[model samples]
Target: MITTLLVANRGEIARRIFRTARAMGLATVAVYSDADADAPHVREADQAVRLGPAAARESYLNVEAVLAAARATGADAIHPGYGFLSENAAFAEVVTAEGLTWVGPPPAAIRAMGLKDAAKALMIAAGVPVTPGYHGESQDPAHLAREAGSIGYPILIKAVAGGGGKGMRKVERPADFTEALGAAKREAAAAFGDDRVLLETYVARPRHIEVQVFGDAHGQVVHLFERDCSLQRRHQKVIEEAPAPGMSDEVRQAVCAAAVRAARAVDYVGAGTVEFIADASAGLRADRIWFMEMNTRLQVEHPVTEAVTGQDLVEWQLRVAGGEPLPLTQDEITLNGWAMEARLYAENPAAGFLPSIGELEHFVLPESVRVDTGVEAGGAVSPHYDPMIAKLIAHGPSRRVAAHRLAAACAQVQVWPVRTNAGFLARCLEDADFLQGEVDTGFIAARLDALAGALAPSDQVLAAAAQGLLSQTPVPAAEPQGPWSALTGFRINGPRQGQVRLYRDGQAVTAPLVDGPLSADVLLNQAGAIVVFEAGEAFAFTGSPPQAITGEGPAGDGVVIAPMPGKVVAVAVSAGDKVLKGQTLVTLEAMKMEHALTAAFEGVVETISVAAGDQVSEGVVLARLTPSA
Candidate 1:
């Protein structure tokens, strides 16, 4: 029996696992880096240990440090939540070798499916349907280009190791193959420490469906249905739902059976996901679906499955790892209500979805829905981890009702200076195409313009802001237009109407306020200049004073600055180098993702301030460029 459980991860997943472990009367330990000393997970655990510095390699990903922490904490088992070393075969092997139970599938199963190339071969040998691709050992760029030609145009280049859409690129033509290959390798190497890549035919109009499968030490395996992660942006899942829309019983049965077979083939134990890609051009069909890959750990979107199946997956993992059989037989398992989960990220949809870093000054979500989050109000969102702030899940008897509740919850998210993708997610849930279940992997990309459009502050929203700024309460409708109605410096008895200056998106606009005091509910968060008002949808406004700039040059001429807190991964140019517009000046790796900084216009490089390995904070100048002489 496991008495003490140490979670070998951090953030929301760590808190999630602890909730289950503590409920089961087990002592829980949390490991955190220097950056997360005060993180919620640290306080949530019975014991907390410092791993190392903020860099993942020296901390969370350092297997020796993790094992040492478990031993120090007297933990009998280590739960490698998701990400980090969750699917690392070596980590699992080391934990078991140390005589501590590893709360995951065996190391052999992880190794069997760790590499995409090897996993595909194993799947083919097991008679599981596989996508046609080049999974060869030779990673020669020229050879891979030739294979892409053989596989036909519009092929997908995927890193042989790792997941989460890193190191993956879509090549639309032969001309772009080489550059794409170089980029794919760099990202793959940085993310997974592997540069090898494989090619496959890009499934047009594809739907990403994955089945939840579980197994036991006693060789029992069963599936708990599938989730549709079709709505995606830049290959990352944005929203997910269970009992995929438009799924037929025939296709569901076939996919679930295949998932169980895949699990049993690996002698899989605990929770794992078998992902499949289906061609939705002809709607849901059993034969059109092909195996994608398997996630050998719990998924980020597991709450939707839990909501629909009425099961706690973490509890099952603990039970299975403790020498127990499968908790429920396949015949006894059944799906109930329809459920949906929307991931709220600390990012700006209007600003290329670049991750934002700051304190959650005024974070608040609707109490009506299930919100799983690691940070609270006033908590910091560090650049050292994923930008996801929380996940909002909703369940109902029907898909329409679930979608409606989830959409409402999205709009109710109130955050401050650090912008969020709540508005973008709200738009996705309310879009007609998504509501009708006409979504695919390309759904967000195709409708990005509409989805990321800035919402102009409505009249009511303006009034609420005015009320909060003026420090006025709701007045009766019968009240006549009085002298104190407007916000302005008054001269003697002034008129009731006047213009109020409000800044939004850095532009100051005059909102005309008429009559007496505004009659609307308004809330002002003292931490920042924010005003919140809840009607059919919740809307919040951050007031900013207009800025005056003296320069009349190009918008990005002066200096190239780091957009967010990150490390300088590569510097492509040096001082005195002449560069054309759109030339890449440097590459910055932030949040384990690479972002290229480009020359805004034709210019001459004046100075390079940072080196390849230097860590930088937001707005730090990396290089300066002057106009051509």
Candidate 2:
């Protein structure tokens, strides 16, 4: 039996594993990087070890360091809690070779499915359904172009080792294939250290369904049904649910059976995920499902599966690692009710989903739902890791109720000081298509504008603002004090009217405040209506004063700089290159993702500030694109 376990990862996943280990009476150890020194997972564990530097490559990805920590801490086992080196075959091999229990699938299974191209080949040999595409080993650009042409338009260029949408592009037209390939290659090289890519015929309106499979050393494997992860952004899953909505009983059984077969073929032990792309355009059908890829570790959206199945997957992993037999038979296991999970990220939805980094001043969520979070209030969202804040999950008797409850829980979350995708998630849940189970991978892209628009301040938000203002005791009517008070001018009689600027969702609005105990009037600029508030709280606005009454002009010659530390991955233009308005000039890779820095207007590249592979910090000038002469 494993008495002590070291989790070779950080954030919510580490915390999650620690929760189960502690409950099972096992000592839990946490490994953290410099940036995550004060992270929640570190505090939650019985013992914590510093791996190395803040960068993932230096810290979590350093398999030797993680194994060394396990040895130093005398941990009997190591549980790689997803991402980083979790799926790295070498890491698993080293752990078992060191006489330590590896609380995941065998290294052989990981190696078998580590690369998508190789995994597809293995699946084909295992008699599993595979997508029709070019999974060849050729890397020649022209060869790929020809393959794309033969595959016809609307093809997907995917990295052989890619996951999380990186190094993947959808080409809707033949003319855009080359450019898309180049972009995908750049991303793939930056992300996976491999530029090898594959091509697949893009399925129209496909639903992403993945099965959770577990195995034991006793030669038994079982699946925990399926989860619908069709709601995605840029190929990364945003929302997931168990017992996929709109799934037919026949198709569900077939998918589960296929997943079990795939696991059995690899002799998979512990937890693994088999993802498949289903052609839901014609409804769920066994013939329409095609194997996508396999994730060899626990998934980020596993909470929904746990909620519906009432199983502690981590405990099962530990049992399986101890050479135990399968916990339950396929016929004995059953899923109840419905569950949903929404990934809450620190990102600006309107700003091309660019990751946001800053201090989390006030991070509060509802207690009605399960929230798996890594950071705490006062923790900084460093630019060294994924910008995910938490995963919120809700379970109910029905899918509709679960979605509605989950949305409500997300909306009630109070996270300030850093922008998040909370508003956008709430809007998606309330969307008619999502509510009716009519969704696919292109759901978010097709409804991007509407979702972004829905993030605007609603009447309830304005009421909260009113309550915030009234609760504030204005400066004495006798004397004008600071800049804010002086600008308003003191009044002896009647309610003193002052214009206060407010910022929300990256937009500014001026609220005309009528200094009253109750019943204050606020005129919203965009709504063009005066809202009467009975009682409200003042919403604290940060950054510079509102632009409405400040008459502040735009910084014409000022350069927009990177707000956090990162690496420059792409320089689209040379020093003398000319660019049009809003044209991309450089793409920065930070926190394991890419962010494009585009031109503010038509300009000539005056100075190429940074090159690919250069590490940058906040305010670093990546480029200087001067206005046209």
How well does each candidate superpose onto the true structure, as a TM-score?
Answer: 0.91, 0.89
Best by lDDT: 1
Cα RMSD, model 1: 4.2
Report the C-alpha lDDT of model 2 over 1-629, residue by residue, as the tens digit. 99999999888899888999989899988999998899889988888999999878899898888888888899999998888888888878889899999898888899889789999999999889999999998989899889988998899999888588999999998788887898899999878788889999999989999999999998899999999999998888899999898888988999999999999989999999999999888888999999999999999998998999999898899889988887899888898999999998888786678788888765666798999989888888888889898999999999999999998887766665566788788888989989999989889999999885433444454444644543453322223457656656466766665655555534666545554343333322223222222211113432233345332223145264675678887778888888888787877887777777888888788778788888898677667767887
Give the per-residue lDDT of model 1 (tens digit) for 1-629: 99999999998899999999989999999999998999999999999999999888999999999999988999999999899999999999999999999999999999888898888888888878988888899988889999999999999999999988899999999999998898889889989999999999999999999999999999899999999999988788999999899998889999999888888888899999999999999998988888889999999999999999999999999999999998899998999989999999998887778898898777788888899998888898989888898999999998989999999888877777577888789889999999999999999999888898656667767766765665543222222456675334354676555556666556665555554555444667664444654422334544456466653333286588888989887888899999998898888989777888989889899999999889998878888898776
Question: What's the lDDT for candidate 1?
Answer: 0.86
Q: Report, for every candidate in turn, its global Cα lDDT versus the true structure.
A: 0.86, 0.81
Give every collision pair in model 2.
Answer: 467-536, 467-537, 467-538, 468-536, 468-537, 468-538, 469-538
Lowest summed-lDDT stretch of 10 residues in model 1? Answer: 472-481
Clashes of each: 0, 7
lDDT of 2 at 220: 92
| Top candidate by TM-score | 1
